[model samples]
Target: MSLTSAPGPGWLLFSFGMGLVSGSKCPHTCLCQTPEVICTGKQLAAYPPDIPLNTRRLYLDNNRITYLPAMNLGLLSDLVYLDCQNNLIREVMDYTFVGVFKLIYLDLSSNNLTLISPYSFSVLSNLVQLNISNNPHLSSLHKYTFANTSSLRYLDLRNTGLQILDHAAFHHLITLKTLYLSGNPWNCNCSLLDFSIYLIVSHLDQPGEGLTGS
Candidate 1:
């Protein structure tokens, strides 16, 4: 005689309100809006597990995701905008964003990345806009890779096949304001002479035009 134990207390409040309306719905192919969760180009290879855990903006663009293991987004720890553009990501292992530490706009453009493990932006220290531009087998860029992003402000390595770029690689980007090393192929020599004298003594913006030198 166990029909929920004799009609219990109103059937236990209608089965606890149907488990809170099935845990706040919206996830099967996503498109929620209570904190955004756009699931772009759903050709996703993974990661779409009933999102909506109070998601704070997440757009898995052009899916087919390849890899990003370490904690693998940990659980979108209150993420703040992330667009994995044209996926098929090759590598980015280290902590893999340690759970979006309140990420502020990041777009791994046209993936297939070569490598970027070391401190990978050191927990994104509240990162402010970054796009690993058109990664076509990204050549090299390991000088402490943005040195902890000190609140970075926009940086998009234009073409991404940068041959050599180690002049302290923007030494800690102390609030860097826009830096997009144009379509790379730059092998200027002398290790690019202190990054061309720190871009003419911090004049900054110069790395646009199709800079090719091999």
Candidate 2:
């Protein structure tokens, strides 16, 4: 299926490494610079299906795109950096990134995301930096939600609707260094006892308030 429909009329195309000799294979709604394809602010309602598979970096920010169904990006095996922030995406189906295993940097902030199943990111064993903040509807979380974040170092969960957190969520994040949990309505209660203890002893650089006791 086509990733997305063309934006029509106005489009932008840039230069590549060896330079364009004759025809250009770039999409009509994006600017391709070889390894990097910038499709920002194109009013896209879905991902451009015609993107090159050899693309390493992709920018799809500031669009109206919604829904990242299963195997949506399965063809981009070489994709490393993906920026899908500031979109209208609601939920990320299972196996959405099935074949895009080389991804290490992902930005899903400023979207309408609500449900993030434990299996949404189960294949990103090499993910290092993840940003899922600014999503007001994303309230709950599960320990298995980060099943493959063993290589994760930076996690951003700021400005979310989180009210509680499980300690086991951080148990396997051995390499984690920075964790942002501010702007959440943390209910510092008995359920967070173990997590509170972890915050007191862990080497993570997490600075926030969690003593609501409500």
Q: What Cα-based lDDT does every candidate model obtain?
A: 0.73, 0.77
Task: Estimate, for each residue in 167-190, the C-alpha lDDT of model 1 and write its tens digit.
Answer: 686777777777888887888888
Judged by lDDT against the true structure, how good is candidate 1? Answer: 0.73
Clashing residue pairs in candidate 2 are none
Candidate 2 lDDT over 1-214, as tens digits, reads 1113322122212212212332235668999998998999999998775677678998999999897643336556688999999999998755577667899999999999898877677778899999999998898887878866799999999877888888888888899988888887777778878988897899788766433424
* Cα error, candidate 1, residue 185 (Å): 3.3
lDDT of 2 at 188: 70
Backbone clash count, each prediction separately: 0, 0
> Pairing residues by index, what is the TM-score of model 1?
0.34
Native RMSD of candidate 2 (Å):
8.4
